[model samples]
Target: MRVLITAATFRSHLYPLVPLAWALRAAGHDVRIAVQPSLVGDVTAAGLPAVEVGRGPDFMSELKKSIDSDGGTPPGTAPSIDKIVVPHIRIAEAVVADLVPFAKNWKPDLVVADPAAFAAPAIAKAAGVPLVLHTWGPMPDQLWADLTSERTARENWPKDLVAFLDTWNVELGPDYADLVVDPCPEELLAIRMAKRQEARYVPYNGAGVTPDWLDEPKRRPRVCITWGTTSEFMGPEVLRPPLLAIEALAGLDVEIVAALGKAGRELLGDAGEQVRVVDWMPLSMLMPTCDALISQGGPGTVLAALVNGVPQLVVPQISAQPLGAELLTNSGAGLTLRPDELTAESVVATVTELLDGDSVRPAARELAERNAARPDPTQLVATLADLAAGR
Candidate 1:
């Protein structure tokens, strides 16, 4: 079977699908990732074959522009969904123009796409293939539905576009997809969509070399502090949590490993000797040894900590992170602190609690067990194959 996996031009969006892409290839299916030209490097870096499609206004730049125009929302405040979805719709329109022709020529049997890869439904319709929506976590279903309706009318898109999507079981009116591959634990989800297939959240933080120190046995409880790669793209003011977290953890008994981009390091200059700062380290390789995780509430970091059964202190900085953090807190796996609520003392207190608390760790372990009970990506290959075969 031939599988075409599509994602927008973001590493966070692309990484979630990597394990599934690998699983399909390992199962003897032909797999190729279709992404905006800017993201080809990221896709190839993950050892997947990448096909660059349509070039135009980049999604991140447009989103940053919107944020700049809005004078920036406070930390932990989600921007209006249209601010997030409109740029994606524009990009998708461009990508679909290019991708439809490519899909016709390549003739993929199935199309697995990120939920925001708005081009996929049309491409799948054009090629007469099954479309699968792969979600990173809980999505704003009503927000997406509203955005799609508003955009379609404003762009004067064909009324039959939604009808064509319906042929594949996609209902844009309610933001339903033919099938959804969800990697989140059931308890954390706020809204459950129909035709959901559960998959384990596998950590894939791109390729990186593991340092020798990481392999050596730890002398004390190790806590990982990270704001994730996206933090680097923002201004310094947006990244106060990592600095506060470092200060909070500095005098603690635990060993701290801080993963910050060069920019982040510069902003939080002279992290004391108590903190070990690296420009990048694969969390998948590093989380196993950590007693707790302190992060800016990026989904990848939150999910990585959960899968590793590490209790977390989440200081959400932007969209979805706040909700993700709250879900973790509600699930008994972690705690959430808004940026305004964050302080060195508060971070220290939370980290200490995560390390010493019994309920949080056990709850994290239970979430991990629930995640593990979901079907592995390799196990999902047959389901995709069956979907491709129209079973």
Candidate 2:
């Protein structure tokens, strides 16, 4: 069977689809990731074949600039639904023009896609194949959209997206999923969609190695801190969390391991011999050794921590990150701090509270166990095979 996977032009969006792709390939199905030209390398890096489609701009840059131009998100508010979804829609539209043609040529039996990858429906419709939407961890974006759409048409994806794809000859709608694959624990989700298929999360942190420090015994409580994955494209200003995190917990006896991107690594100067800063280390490996995690609320990052049962302190920056922050806090598995609320004192207090108290540990551990109990991706291959074979 031939499987075609599609994603928005971002690593966070692309990574969620990898596990299933891996499962399909292992089962002897041909799988190729269809993405914008720039993301082809990421697909290949994950050891899958990539088919380059239409052009797309730097969406992270566009998102950063859009947020900056609006003077950042309001104190109590996240960036608007349009601001977040529009960039994805734009890139998805760009990929569709080429994608429709490719799907016709490849004639994939199934199409697996990121929920945000709006182009997949057109491909599924064009090729007369089954389309399945896969999610990335806690999906606050969809929750927010569902809530906001109730009050205004602007925030509704199915309505707005259907109208947006008017030019395409095929019948396309955002509601076009034959099955929905979810890896997130129910505790982390606020809203549930229809036709959901439960799948265990397989973390795909791009091209990596096990660090040497993993072999060393921890002399104290270890904390894993990261700036999430999108900061490099946004530039240095977005790299402040790691610096502030170091400051917040400076006098504490905890060992800090900061996983940063290229910009974050450069921005972080010498933080003494106690701090371990690596440019790219998978949190899946690091979270198991840590006592707590502190980072921005990117679904992928937080889910990595959650899967390992690590208590978290999220500093939400953009889009549905705040929504994720709220759900985590409600679940008692984690805590949240808005950008305005972030401070040395607050971070220290939260970190200490999570570390010193056993309050959230049970919930965090339960959530992890529940997520681990979900059907693995290899198991989902049969489900997809059935869908492809019209079962």
Top TM-score: which candidate number? 1
Which lDDT tens digits does candidate 2 get at residues 1-391? 8999998877888988888898999999999898888888988988999998867556776665667776786443455765676666667677888888888888999998987777887778788998888988888645323533333433455554655555554332235478889898777775675678877887776777777779788899998888876565555677676678887788898888888767766777787767887887877678889999988888998888888889999988876687788889999999988777878898888999889888888888888888888899999999899999999
Instruction: Encode model 1's per-residue lDDT on 181-290: one tens digit a residue.
Output: 99988767855656788889998888898899998988889998887766545555665678777777768888888887777778767876678888788889999989
lDDT of each: 0.80, 0.79
Candidate 2 clash pair list:
none
TM-score for each candidate, following the candidate numbering: 0.90, 0.89
lDDT of 1: 0.80
Model 1: lDDT of residue 326: 81
* Residue pair clashes in candidate 1: none
